[model samples]
Target chain A: MIHRFLFHDINEGLIRHAKRYVLVVIVVVITCSMIDSMSAYFMDYFGEYWSPIEYGINEFYGRYPFVFDINSTDKFTIPFGWVLIYLFLAYMIGDYIYKDMNGYGMYMMIKSKKRWYWWISKCLWCVAVNVFYFGLLWISNIAYSWMKHGDIAFYQESDLRMSYYGFGFDNMGMPKLLLVVIVMPLLVGIVQSILQITLTLIFNSVATMTIIAGILMLSCYYGSIYIPHSYAMLIRYFSNESDPDFVAVDAGTGIAVLGIGIVAMVVMGYMIFRKKNVISNR
Target chain B: MKIELKNISKVIKKNNVLEDINYTFTGGCVYGLIGKNGCGKTMLMRLIAGLIYPTSGSVCINDKILGKDISFPDSIGILIENPEFLNDYTGFENLKLLAGLQKNVDEQEIKDTLTSVGLDYNDKRKFYKYSLGMRQRLGIAAAIMGKPEIILMDEPINAIDEDGVAIIRDLIRGLVDKNRIIIIACHDKEEMDYLADKKILMSSGKIVKEMIV
Candidate 1:
């Protein structure tokens, strides 16, 4: 029963808070589709006409011993489409986390008694939104592929793999992608929310929270970049291997990381919320 | 229903905003919280609303701490600060969203609240298009829509016109008669003088006066 309330509250919060961004999300979707369409067109033209010219140039330069053959229609469409899809999902999830942290919306959800229900519902809703968006992309891609190559067999024949499409359709796929998209953003949002609520309690100004968020983002970015190559390689080895066994290991590790991050965030956010003084809004 | 604050004190960065305050408000009374700017009137109200926690005290409603309970005051309505609304939403849309927070608050109740507050429910204008006075009326409409047991308002009459104020005054009276707790935080002596059954005055975060008006 409590879970039901939390679920309803979570949905209410998303509708009240995140609904305002529907326009922006739609614009992003349209922009992504257009970019995908243009890139596909370019790749098609390049494969059909420019490949022979490039092969001749490389042959004359003596850097290439053989002229490489390029297919006029490849299945993979520049991977820009996938990247844009990921980015759009990231933006929506990131914005939701950001606003919730900033104390703009979701105040009531955060206040609800069923904490786990609220957290899980939010996670699921974000994933659902992402799935709906990526589904649109898949449909567009299929349509474009049909128009360009005349049949599904052409796509199958191409060397290019529709790996991302497979990723989107698998049972555990959307959840894994959502885990990735929300992990870092939600971590940062949770930390920022905690720091904001704490600082607001102590300093009583909204500007302090903004400044802290900016500093935290910058430091995290630079800190990640400066990690030693050996450490980077170790981190990469855990998730980047292509073997089937390694893929399972990678997914398990990813889920564990996501679970830990989310749990830590909720605990911290709850502690801070409990201690926060709901002084009059300035 | 009753709200109790025991020895509540708040200090932000060594600046004391509220100091060792104790008060209890039972159901069925209209309270006017009067104080100068920075006297911690707003902070006190927030404490009651469970928006913020005091530095070293407890706020309880109906013998339960706010965060511990499954629900907050079962039905408590509040309009803090400027009575924030989504700027892009229509007045009716905003009311609908907030009213849906509780059970059994029908569309007719929402329409009636808007009408009683002197707002045209059918107007196509968004909340951003409303004048200052109109916004106040809309805020009142939202506060009353849920038929909450307790209503908290902060300067609800700040930007309202005389007619709007009169309507609000009567609305508070009506709410009180219905055995609801109505708490208004304001500095306007004239309005407070007319509406408040009890006045609690504060200065520099301490209660300077408490009088039955």
Candidate 2:
């Protein structure tokens, strides 16, 4: 019975999400355009053929570790492509549970006969959305490469990436590319989305969403290894891999941190939501 | 089956919504929770449905305490406040989706419930295009679909027309049985007198009067 309810709930979420398919596709097209144009500009300037992995690296490659200097003045610049992708995904998925609780979600909760089932179904729903969102990102990039007649391979111009993004890439492999593009971003997306849902249970939707967006922005401004958002940026890994002052959080550490973060947030949310007084404040 | 609320009280933002409510609801009866807008009728309903926990009380159903032995009533249905559904789904589809949770009722049961509430079972209009009365009918249909042991409806007839109200009144009356409990929260005193076996009048978060109908 629980499985049946979960299946239906997930289907409901995906169906509702389908209404936004056109909008999501448009966002993807615009994002892909931006990334492709930037790659073309860099290729024209450097006079070299860039692989698809270079575009992927550039998309996930955020700013290097920030060092605060009192004497030298430098403006904090955000990685537009990276921030746009994460922030947009956050906004897309951050409000469904909150809104649903006031609406049909409460009805479904009573019907499911267990609060844990409802919460778990929502967690799984978030995971599904993140998967779909990231899958679209990958497919969009592939389609863009195909359209532009670009080489699609697990290869990166190490020198170009190093001089341009200030990162040291000793070697590039398929595992590394997949880790950065698919695994890391997807993990962060699921973790942040779950965190937002948990927070919305305690706060209003606007406040909760703002808190999530603020965390992402702060991660961009300061590349502290302690910040989980830093692990999503590939530049952080390459830049601090050899730096003695910073402990390089590799893909394994990121997966561990984000995986644990997902479990902890799920448990905490279940504990709070099970005892919560569900009222229609919205 | 019996539902006993032992000294129920709820405080929201430091304001007492339901103050020390102690009541026992038994099977084979229709209960009318009568009050104005914010006199705790809906809060009392919420407490009973296990949608909200009482600050210093426990809702016990058949000796099983809510929040301890069970999270909610084992078999219960509710339509609190306004009816909310996915706007893109048809009325039948909405009920079908909800009915999938328990899997206790089939498509025929859902279609019958819709017809019982004066809604066309084959209506193809999306819920967003439904009128106020049609929405109310769908809400009532959802609450009563599976013949739950306990049913809670708040303002179940707010936007219903005269003919629709008559049809629903008869529907509720026909649902009375030896093993079922039906509770309705409404503002119409006449309708309460007509339908409820007992009328509970609440004022300022306390039960001010109880009249046998």
Which candidate number would show the highest TM-score if scored against the true structure? Answer: 2
Clashes of 1: 5
lDDT of 2 by residue, B118-163 (tens): 9998899999999999999999999998999999989888999999
lDDT per residue, candidate 2, A1-282, as tens digits? 556555755666666666664544565567556765655666566665445556566667777665566876876688877887877777767577877777888888888778888889888888888888878777766666666656565565565565555544656466786687668888988988898889988988789878987998888877665577878887677645534566556787887888899999999999989888877433
Report the lDDT tens digits of candidate 1 across residue range B23-73: 988877889999889999888877676666677887788788765663345
Considering every candidate listed, which one attains the maximal DockQ?
2
lDDT, residue A149, model 1 = 47
Worst 10 residues of 2 chain A by lDDT: A239-248
Q: Please list the C-alpha lDDT of all candidates, in the order they appear.
A: 0.55, 0.81
Query: Model 1: residues >4 Å from true position, as ranges?
Result: A1-125, A132-249, A256-282
User: Candidate 1 chain B: worst 10 consecutive residues by lDDT?
Assistant: B66-75
